[model samples]
Every structure is written in structure tokens, then in C-alpha cells.
Target: MKKILVVDDEFDILTTWRLILEMEGYEVTTASNGRVALESARANPPDLVITDWMMPHMDGVAFIRELAANDSLAQVPVILMSAAAHAPTLEHGNAQFRRKPLSIDDLLDLVKHKLGEA
Candidate 1:
């Protein structure tokens, strides 16, 4: 099973995503902020990372930069979500941007496509 790390500030969003991904047979791990997510990722590198753009302490962009700098985790695919009209530009090619208020089906489809599970 592919492991996925999900990072979001909202508790509800975190739990909801965990349940959804778990149901899809992915090993799901969640963190409330980018700081925690970074630690989690370093401890057990995930196949994919789904993160919120704005987060407390460390933002998604910073986290992605750190992840990219690390050789072991540099190749991990990342999906960044935001409520803003425009998503931030990422330097890494292994990253995807998605608008917030996302549909569960669409998110799942994107995850599947990124993980090559579709």
C-alpha cells in the first residue's frame, strides 16, 4: 500500500482526508501543520504529500522546499491546495496545485493519477 502524508491546519479537514484516503486503501498519516508534517515525512517518507498552502509555523511552500532539498524525500509527489484564487508557483516539477473547496471525487482522482493507481 502506498503511504500518503496529509497536512492541514483544520482538524476536520485532516480527519476527513484521513478517512477518505484510508478507505481508498492508502496508508494515511496526518499532521496539523507543516512543521509536524515535515518531521513525520522525515521519519517515514511518504509516497505522496497533500498539503494546505497556508499553515501555522511552517507554510506548505517552505515545507516543500525543505523536502526538495533532502535527497531521500526529493522525489516524493506533492499536491498543494489553497482557497486563494491563484496557487503559488512551485519550483519542483513533482508538485501539483489544486483549488480549495475541492470535490472529494476529484481529489481522489488526482491522488490516484499522481500515485499511478488509476
Candidate 2:
């Protein structure tokens, strides 16, 4: 099964994503912030990372940079989401940006596409 790490400060969102992804047959791990997620990823890297742009402890941009710096985790694809209208330009090529309030079906489709199942 493909493993996916989902990071979001909001408990509800995190849980929702975890449950939905698991139902789709993906092994899912979740973290409240980028800091925790990075630590977990270092110990056991996931195939993909889905993160929220704004988070406490560490934000998405900083997290992506850290992830990219690590050779072990650098190749993992990332999906970044935010409610903010302005999206930051990502230096990483393996990441895709999406605005928030997306439906579960759309999210699943994106996840599949990111994982090269599209």
C-alpha cells in the first residue's frame, strides 16, 4: 500500500483526510504541524506528503525546503493546500499547489495523480 503523510494544524481536517485516504486504500499518517511531520518522516518516510500552507511551529514553505534538503525524502511528491488567495512560488518541482475547500473526490483524484497513478 502507498503511504501518505498529511499535515494540518486543524484536528478535524487532519482526521477527515486520514479517514478518507485510508478508505481509498492508502496507508495514512498525520501530524499537527510541519515540525512533527518532518521528524516522523525522517524516521519513516512516506511516499507522499499533503500539507496545509499555514501552520504553527513550521509552515509549508519551510517544511518543503527542509524535506527537499534531505536526500532520503527529497524525491517524495507533495501536495500543498491553502485558503489564502496568494500562492507562493515553490522552488521544488515535485510539489503541486491547490486552494482549499476542495471536495473529497477531487482530493482523491489529485492524490492519485501525484502518486503517478493518474
User: What's the TM-score of every candidate structure?
Assistant: 0.96, 0.95
lDDT per residue (tens digit) for residues 1-118 in model 2:
8999999999999999999999888999999999999998999999999999899999988898899999999999999999989888876769888999979989999998877451
True-vs-predicted CA distance for residue 114, candidate 2, Å: 1.9
Report the poorest 10 consecutive residues by lDDT, candidate 1: 109-118
TM-score, model 1 to reference: 0.96
Q: Candidates' lDDT values, in order?
A: 0.92, 0.91
CA displacement after TM-score superposition, residue 11 of candidate 1 (Å): 0.5
Give candidate 2's total backbone clashes. Answer: 0
Whole-model lDDT, candidate 2? 0.91
Residue-pair clashes per candidate = 0, 0
Candidate 2's displacement at residue 14, Å, is 0.3
Which residue ranges in model 1 land beyond 4 Å of their true spot?
Answer: none
